[model samples]
Target: MPILLLGNKDIDLISGKRNITIRRLWKQPLYRGDRLFCYWNILSKEREKIFEAEVTKVKILPFKEIISNSELPHKLGYKNSKELEKDLKKSYPNNTKDNDEFQIFEFKKLHVTQWEGSAINQKNMIIKKADILFDMGEYEQSSLCYQAALEYDPDDANLLNRIGDNLSRLGQFGDAIKNYKKAIKLQPDNEYLYNNIALVYLNKGEPDNALKMSNEAFKINPKNTTILYWRGIIYEMLNDFEEALKYFDEVLELDDTDPDVWNERGTLLNMLGKSEEALISYDKSLELCLDDTKDSNTWASKGNTLLGLQRYDEAIECYDNALKIDDSNPIILNNKGVAYMELDDFQSAIECFTKVLVMYPNNPDAQVLQEVCLENL
Candidate 1:
């Protein structure tokens, strides 16, 4: 069974047969212990009991998991665990998995527990809310909230670091760099802050600066995946493809299901003319991508590879997919039109050229192609 929010205040944990209100759950930060108890009435309407649980054991409900389970049989059992494992593997074909590993797709039911010292305090409330906002993509507001929180607790390393992260997400890379540096100054031994600073520099195309910060971060915490990712980005920007791949490969070993990493590795492989490896990377990315709609770059890359292999029809299909995502993309449209012309589809080529011409009226190549297509017609 799947959990769903009922009304505005209560959540129905259908699988657990429990209905609990948000107010009943113990908020943390001011709480003394990591356990919570929730008092709830079971679906049988005959028994009322409070359940105790650990905070770290709590899980948040996932929308995708809920939607996936909607049409399944109501009976619950562990019989389909093997199938679930297979699905996870398919979701990340390039990743390794243990034979007995199990993954819970969603969170545990919300409950109130006994023995917590105090409810969530004011400072904790603000921090939690700011984190929620950041997760929801409200970076500007989250950063402002985090800044206010840091004012009262300037020595708090985590708060300072998060403020830097929010600023970076808001595209204030310069400010983010400053905040990360401040965090490092306050906590000299913190490798995470160094990694964050390196990331901002990489985002701003300061590869040399990124390299310096990443190296320092790595020296402090060599096994830190975040620092490794920054180092990989810096190396990639510096055209040290081999070094970049090494870092990315390590990241994959740590967490192979990262679609972004696979896509990035594939792109570098393509640049290095490792067509087969690039294809594998692209396939892994496509498998992980939840959206059926193709991205402009995805289609363009696939089309370019197919063209290299002289698979004209397949290349045209990939370009068409790209055009569907971004109709105004002149480069893809032009290249697609060229593919059509190679297949002797003059009129179709003309249509693609015309679309590009609409976006760039003075595009000489489009004009020339249109003229040639008209002549052929």
Candidate 2:
């Protein structure tokens, strides 16, 4: 069977938004009327058959000719010719030249019953849709899709776990726990199910219950970094700072590249009054983070550390960076106000406090700080 492996970028093809695909010529090139089995090559190395299609047309063109055509690149899923050229070079470094031949395959999707391979699995396709929705942060819609998928495979433990994840994201903690428990019943040996249960409990502010689930996961796989990180969080919530630090350190020793673990370690060190050591950990976390916006909390935490060290100007800069990503956070705004007050910049401090007060009218801290700034001025 001729297979067509699609990446995340090709998801629109499954939704019928796209019908054309450009590729470097395969050794056994697809011809008109050839049946193609399309599957999503997920990041987890799992391939889920999305659809089967019949090639309706084939056009052969040189690489340069394709890039030179404005409309052609868009039809092939690129924003423009420049993007198409860059991707072609990266995808086929050795073959992508001005004269290299490429094939444009236009295909029409076949209904499930019309497929030549094993009938398209409706459950898997729904799960794929749910996963995409989940990644897009449409938790409610993703949960509905996962629930619909359950009708096809009620006993699928992984599907149950995914539904649990969606529910957790939606803040439906009780229902999330029920789904996770159901998954655990179906796949008792899966440590991740236990880990999911722990996270739900953690979110619910039931650290004792979270610890119980974490311990169960630990018994299954003590060396797992994820389980260890959660154990540290659970311990921190229980106010066992020393024990939490141990677990965080254990996680770092095993995999030092995790920015989240480093951030957690920094928080723990700061709580323990080791401000200098905490600064180092926060810096490490920031260095490991690739996207500044995604690590806004780390930036805010670093600001707190700098404030503790009496580096008022540097602290304000860190808070400013965090505010650029999360301007609506009143706590960050108030902290920035505090930093300005520490530097004796009353006007700037008042501006920060006023912003916080605007967001949270009943914020007593902001009100008091703004009043102090006014009195100082």
Q: Pick the candidate with the highest lDDT.
A: 2
lDDT of 1 by residue, 66-169 (tens): 22453321222213535543444554454323322222222243333333433333346457656766887877767766765665578888888898998898
Could you estimate the TM-score for every candidate? 0.61, 0.65
Backbone collisions counted per model: 6, 0
Whole-model lDDT per candidate? 0.66, 0.88
Off by over 4 Å in 2: 1-119, 358-362
Clashing pairs in 2: none
- Flag clash pairs in model 1: 36-113, 37-112, 37-113, 38-111, 38-112, 59-107
Total backbone clashes of model 1? Answer: 6
Q: What is the lDDT of candidate 1?
A: 0.66
Residues 257-304, model 2: lDDT tens digits: 999899999999999999989989988998998876657999999999
Each candidate: RMSD: 17.3, 11.8
